[model samples]
Target: MDSSSAIHGYVAEFEKAEQLVAATRRTRLAGYRVFDAYSPFPVHGLDEAMGHPRTILPWLVFLGGLAGGVGGYLLQYYPHVIDYPLNVGGRPLNSWPSFIPVTFEMTILGAALVAVFGMIILNGLPQHYHPIFNLERFERASQDRFFLCIETKDPKFNKTETREFLLELGASEVSECEE
Candidate 1:
């Protein structure tokens, strides 16, 4: 431990996806909540091992689509019925059937847009910096390496003990992250 700097966490490198998953499960069982696992590609059952809950993205998208549909309907209704009444081709000014296509398109647009933005925001995207990025070999994370990090903020974090625990899990190497 350095006196001038603060420790952010400890990162452990694993050789295989299975190894990472097993280590993650062990870590979770060991009562460490402030931890994360990283893999080059998606690994099955990793979320279950990490004990992450289901997301509310589906509900958010549904509400966004509903709002868009209602707004679309009102936009056309107000203009053709209330703002300036127009009886085109003997059809009523408040003809809701004619507004269906536009409303449907707007609904799709709203849902898609909300999904894109919501995922980005929810996942904390556009983050250009993190303490993990300070690791020299961390760039391999996007290539072939797998990593599991136990943050210092964890209630049960003990730097020396955590390092030894990761080594016991067969980590290829363990690095300390400082911020």
Candidate 2:
């Protein structure tokens, strides 16, 4: 297929989130890559059931904070002491106590920024369109429905076979999802 030619896959629509969740669990257990899921609200245990790996956002935040803390301390220290030494209250150059508060604040700010940006990138947000959104009934996703989309890129995805598999897994309705 041409690189510009999108390989469309079928979508199995469900009336309830529970049905979709259960189907996703089975599909993952069968070793299929799930493209995404849509739910009205957060569903407890759904991520675990889908076998989603743990997120690295926390680690990224920590590293960012560490770098910020070091940077803030160095910026203050280099300017106040090394670049132009200033004697005040007989305090020694490179005073550790004076730098603590500013360092702490900078660390928190950096971590917060990193956390926000990391989450956005990791979650792939700001998407204007999706194949699943093309389905007529998918408008209920933000209301009372849940959806699981297994992409055509999945190794085991055969149009006919996947539909049959979804149906057997108790999908309320299965319809083709196109992009």
Candidate 3:
């Protein structure tokens, strides 16, 4: 599938987070895959309730940090000791203690950089447009409303059936979301 075409879904708007959560639970129980949720404020337990799997970002961050730490150590050691031996205060050329600060800083920098890039890649950021944005009322999502999107890619998704399902789930109103 084309990368940009991966976000086909219908959006349901709710006035309250609780209603959105309840509707989401019902949809999941009915074996529907919910694409995502949008709310102005953070909604507690949304991830677990939506059954999202644990992300690999932490692992990526760890590996990036480890690489940064090693790189920093080598950069310092190779230049100061191997390339040009520096014996300050009669201390050993390969002094490890002095390298701690640089290693620590690089580790943090690399981990933070990896974390940002990993999250963007994992979540598919930089999306210029989405079908749901075309819906008139959807603009409320960033104000005082909550939204639950059920993607067409879901195994149980059918245009007619899904519309009927949302209507039955106490949706104040239902509208077609098109790309």
TM-score of each: 0.93, 0.85, 0.87
Which candidate number maximizes TM-score?
1
Measured by TM-score, how close is model 3 to the native structure? 0.87
* Candidate 2 C-alpha lDDT tens digits along 50-160: 877799999999999999899989989999889998889898988989899999999998899999999998988877766677788889889877777777888777777
**lDDT tens digits, residue span 37-129, model 3:** 889998987877788889999999999999889988998999998899977899988889989999999999889999999999998897887
Q: C-alpha displacement of 108 in model 1, angstroms?
A: 0.7
Regions of candidate 3 where Cα sits further than 4 Å from its true position = 1-8
Query: Which ranges of candidate 1 are over 4 A from the true structure?
Result: 1-5
Whole-model Cα lDDT of every candidate shown, in order: 0.90, 0.80, 0.83
How would you encode candidate 1's per-residue C-alpha lDDT over 1-179 as one tens digit per residue? Answer: 35414877889998899999999999999999999998889999899999999999999999889988898889898889899997779978888898999999989988888988999999899898888888888899999999999998888888789999999999999998876
Model 2 / residue 68 / CA error / Å:
1.1
Error of 1 at 162 (Å): 0.4
Clashing pairs in 1: none
Clashes of each: 0, 0, 0
Which is the better candidate, 2 or 3, if ranked by TM-score? 3
Query: lDDT score, residue 17, model 2?
Result: 66
